[model samples]
Target: MTLRHTRPEARPAWRKSSYSHNDGDCVETAPVRASVAIRDSKDLSVGTLAVPHDAWTYMVDALKG
Candidate 1:
């Protein structure tokens, strides 16, 4: 679903994907404890997608396939 930071000002340092397009349609991610936080680069105020560490690895591997 959606994940949100309690304090909007205290956001983690999110990094945009290298494959992101020049347009605003990009995704950003930040590493949290045992999980990864994903969000839209164009709208950080919306919310985040929290993926577990193992799940993230699996998803990446699958995408590379």
Candidate 2:
């Protein structure tokens, strides 16, 4: 995947979900080129889950509905 080729410094900055309550149970997200990455906010080593941009949008829209 293209994400693997992304340099650490070149990766987009991750931001925690707005719904997060500043607790340990938060998730962070970042745009990775055409995809969006989600990861545990409490542990950087937990790994990331990347989803297609459209899929991410769909999920967000569904939740908002």
Candidate 3:
């Protein structure tokens, strides 16, 4: 499936990973429209990834493994 590129301004909220460290390691997420928005905690303005709720859950579960 092809993912659409979303503009940063289009995102309503942004969240950071609780497990993130200040040493340039971590990710953040927030609800954006019907999906979730993610960005690097270290550089939020630069790297953003938008994912659907179902895919987000699968990604999180995979990360836990």
lDDT of 2 by residue, 1-65 (tens): 22354567886688987788856779988898888988887876767889999999999999999
Whole-model Cα lDDT per candidate?
A: 0.84, 0.81, 0.71
TM-score on alpha carbons, each prediction: 0.76, 0.78, 0.62
Question: RMSD to native for every prediction?
Answer: 2.7, 2.6, 4.6
Estimate the lDDT of model 3.
Answer: 0.71
TM-score of model 2 vs. true structure: 0.78
- Between the candidate structures 1 and 3, which one is better when assessed by TM-score? 1
Sorted on lDDT, highest at the top, how do the candidates line up?
Answer: 1, 2, 3
Estimate the lDDT of model 2: 0.81
Off by over 4 Å in 3: 1-11
TM-score of 1: 0.76
Candidate 1 clash pair list: none
Candidate 3 to native Cα RMSD, angstroms = 4.6
lDDT (10s digit) by residue, model 3, range 1-65? 22244786754565657777778688767786777777767665585677899999998899999
Worst 10 residues of 3 by lDDT: 1-10
What's the CA error at residue 24 for candidate 1, in Å? Answer: 2.5
* Per-residue alpha-carbon lDDT of candidate 1 for residues 1-65, written as tens digits (9 for 90 to 100): 46556987766778889999999789988888779989998886787888999999999999999
